[model samples]
Target: MPRQRKRACQDTPEPETEAPAGKLVKANKAEIPAEPLGEAKTSDSPEKNRATKESGNETSRYWLMKSEPESRLEKGIDVKFGIEDLKAQPRQTACWDGVRNYQARNFLRTMKLGEKAFFYHSNCKEPGIAGLVKIVKEAYPDHTQFEKDSPHYDPSSKKDNPKWSMENLILS
Candidate 1:
């Protein structure tokens, strides 16, 4: 079997519970098909694993992104850009942004266009895999990190070469 990459994220913070309403949406998938249940076959055979590993031209990639239902500031408001929030969007589309951590920011840089990411809810009563979102847009500088009024703003981050990046993840 192939070895998985050791990411910087240690605590997933996902609690087992009900799923989110964000699943009932759609997105473009000309190459890969959507699975509403978020279930897929995991090959254990050496031959099958070797075959997948040999497919160097494969463009699709999978990911799991964790988000909190309510942020520290929005705790009492019962509002944070969770799965529900993404579903509430005009077209059920949103971007995974405002990542202040350096390590997480680096992970975002690795995201490629059309990559599939599982939207997992964290810091909530029912924290678990909620739905799926596709990386419609690739990594780019996060504009919020430049705004002085925004909590994600970084004074040290230069405009030419920003310290953070973000990607558009729409419901799939």
Candidate 2:
């Protein structure tokens, strides 16, 4: 019988790191520059800033609120949850927090009192518009931003200059 030769793992070449066609490659340290303390800059151009301000000033802003039916439902048939709900009774309004996306944060900042928002259920079997809600108050600092124990807390966010904000909402 012929003896089998042993293969060395180190002798085999490693696979190339090329991405599939049309896919973007991840940026490395050389491609992405590190920000210095207090030197962070925004990429918003003058035109873009003007457009954002204009859009924010426009009345009748629309929004969508997502809630899990199983998590917030009182009765199986109850479609709307309000301040009267046991879980929501302590605070007439709940702080809408944990939004890390800057664009979504900007949207939250644009909410005004009496503004209408459609309540939608995402990641559900039947995801669609569930009900309607009204903005009871304008944007205010989300307290969760300051609590280090909270999952939403951001060390980069200062209490005096909180980056996360939310508004009081009520079922309509």
Candidate 3:
């Protein structure tokens, strides 16, 4: 008996007659409608729009911050104890930086001049609220991002148009 070779039609499965591209395919769930790219759809309801506007205008009435006592002690030693010692430390005057969360970013955006925040020390043996900080200036471009040697440098950020920033805060 001679060996036989299969024809292309015999080897391959026949292609099904199906709907063309862009046509809806039958599925278990209904297809989700996609919004146009780069543009957010606004609510048609007037009440929803009014509520959104009001919420955007609302100031962050309060906030809390944290620092470590051991880190503070490592930085410097002081004869005075308690809140006074913490207040006297140089780190107390340091700016709050490196916050990357979108919600935190939004809060930072909402922060206005003179807004007060409670400084709290965490991840330490004695974790608790430490002191008060006043927002001395509104949000501005963070200089750290521009430094090539800095850990915070972002290549995406430019000197003219910065994405990340810091706010001037003073101890009170």
Each candidate structure's count of clashing pairs:
1, 0, 3
lDDT against the true structure, per candidate, is 0.60, 0.48, 0.46
Off by over 4 Å in 2: 1-58, 68-93
Give residue 78's lDDT in candidate 3 (0 to 100): 21
TM-score rank, highest first?
A: 1, 2, 3
Q: Please give the TM-score that candidate 1 achieves against the real structure.
A: 0.67
Q: Pick the candidate with the highest TM-score.
A: 1
> Per-residue CA lDDT of candidate 1, range 1-172, in tens?
2221111111222223333445433333223222322323346865444222235544355776767766555212222567767776645566666788876777788876666787876666666667887766778878767867555668999999899887776677
**Scored by Cα lDDT, where does model 2 land?**
0.48
Q: Write the per-residue lDDT of candidate 3 for residues 1-172, one digit (tens) a residue.
A: 2221111111111222321222111222222222111222256775434222245653334465433444332113221123433344343344545454556655666676656665555555555555666665666666666756554557778899877756655556
As a TM-score, model 3 comes out at 0.50
TM-score of 2: 0.52
Candidate 3 residue pairs that clash: 65-120, 66-120, 67-121
